[model samples]
Target: MSPIVVPSRLKLFGLVILILFLCFPYGGAAYSPHMASVVRISQIYSGGGNASSPYGCDFVELFNSSSVAV
Candidate 1:
């Protein structure tokens, strides 16, 4: 019968580290546009802002698929 060689704890740990490095390949503090979202002009008004206007300036309304506001 052939002998089976079980890896030592330290060797196993190193193997796990190598596997992680190989799988991830790189690291960084990064963001994805897909995870976030893109905002689009939902509405627009032609009138200039006045004292009567609540929003101030010629305002534009933006919208996105996400419920969370930016």
Candidate 2:
């Protein structure tokens, strides 16, 4: 029939425990197989205006779509 008063330290501890319980699964970074499969490609095109160049400006680039840079 009455409210219970909890000490400040106890309250803080309870809050921390609650947060950890709610966030433990997602607190750290996660990886997805679908994202791992992603790939990026970059290409360069050459035009007739640069016919004098011995090598056309042709290049290729690749990238990964994960949170980590590769």
Candidate 3:
């Protein structure tokens, strides 16, 4: 039988780094991609005079810049 051959210190360090990288994986960023927002608030109106009331209800509108649903 042949004697067991031990890996060098540098090789061991590299192997440990590789294992850690595979286990953790860039702070888990590789699993989720960065989100890009295409939808934005277009208009808002509050405290406007309509007929007689001094304070009015607020209005909010949403606009989609992209063609795809987001």
Candidate 4:
């Protein structure tokens, strides 16, 4: 059986991809604490201002998912 050979263009493309991946910044497991989303939209009431709804205005409720005070 003959040996399998790879093309030079494919090898060059693979090397370029590797270099680009190594040169650019990627987001990993380590992230800043301030970058976390502490507050989130807990509830959204779009049925407001209707006849069956109790509230007369549409509102969005926000809740803090973290333990820190806002």
Candidate 5:
């Protein structure tokens, strides 16, 4: 067999894609004025606590920022 060779244009395109992926933000932002899902997981508590622990249990709290009912 022989070593594979990549075209210069293809390499440049790959570099551009990598730069874009690194420079720009991935996934949705934390807060948005015009967001679809208003409900968010405000707090998360996991694992059972020890001698002086509050609540003493795991719980996931959700908060609704929007006024409309979900």
Candidate 6:
């Protein structure tokens, strides 16, 4: 018996569909207005006491653009 082979285009289309299915939820989640309000802040503090605080002491500020709290 001869081995069967699949076409590359069909394989690629299948892969794209699979990826879209897996990512659909994540993509939908990202579109939420709540996500737009979410903010990520980072600060680095020097170990030494003498080190001057950056920005008058490292801090993080989260702004809620939306009325709802996340």
Q: Which one is best on TM-score?
A: 4
Model 6 worst lDDT window (10 residues): 41-50
lDDT of 3 by residue, 1-70 (tens): 9998777997899999999999987676443232255667899776566766566666788888878776
lDDT of 3 at 34: 24
Model 2 C-alpha lDDT versus the unseen true structure: 0.72
TM-score of each: 0.34, 0.33, 0.35, 0.43, 0.40, 0.35
Tens digit per residue, CA lDDT, model 1, 1-70 = 9998776997889999999888877674477776455677889976667777766668688778677566
Candidate 4 structure quality by residue, lDDT tens digits, 1-70: 9998999999999999888888775833576577468878889998889999999999999988778887
Residue 63: error of model 5 in Å?
Answer: 0.6
- The runs of at least 3 residues in candidate 1 whose Cα sits more than 4 Å from the true structure, single-residue gaps closed, are 1-7, 28-30, 37-70
Report backbone clashes per prediction: 0, 0, 0, 0, 0, 0
What digit string (tens of lDDT, one per residue) describes model 6 on residues 9-69?
A: 9999999999998889566654655475565444444433445634445444555555565
Residue 12 accuracy (lDDT) in model 4: 100
Tens digit of per-residue lDDT, candidate 2, span 27-67: 77788777657867655545434868666565566776667
Error of 2 at 9 (Å): 0.5
- Candidate 5 residue pairs that clash: none
- lDDT, candidates in the order shown: 0.76, 0.72, 0.73, 0.84, 0.80, 0.64
lDDT of 5 at 45: 79
Candidate order (lDDT): 4, 5, 1, 3, 2, 6
- Where does candidate 1 have its weakest 10-residue lDDT segment? 28-37
Q: In model 5, what lDDT does residue 40 have?
A: 87
Model 1 local distance difference test score = 0.76
Question: Model 5 off-target regions past 4 Å?
Answer: 1-36
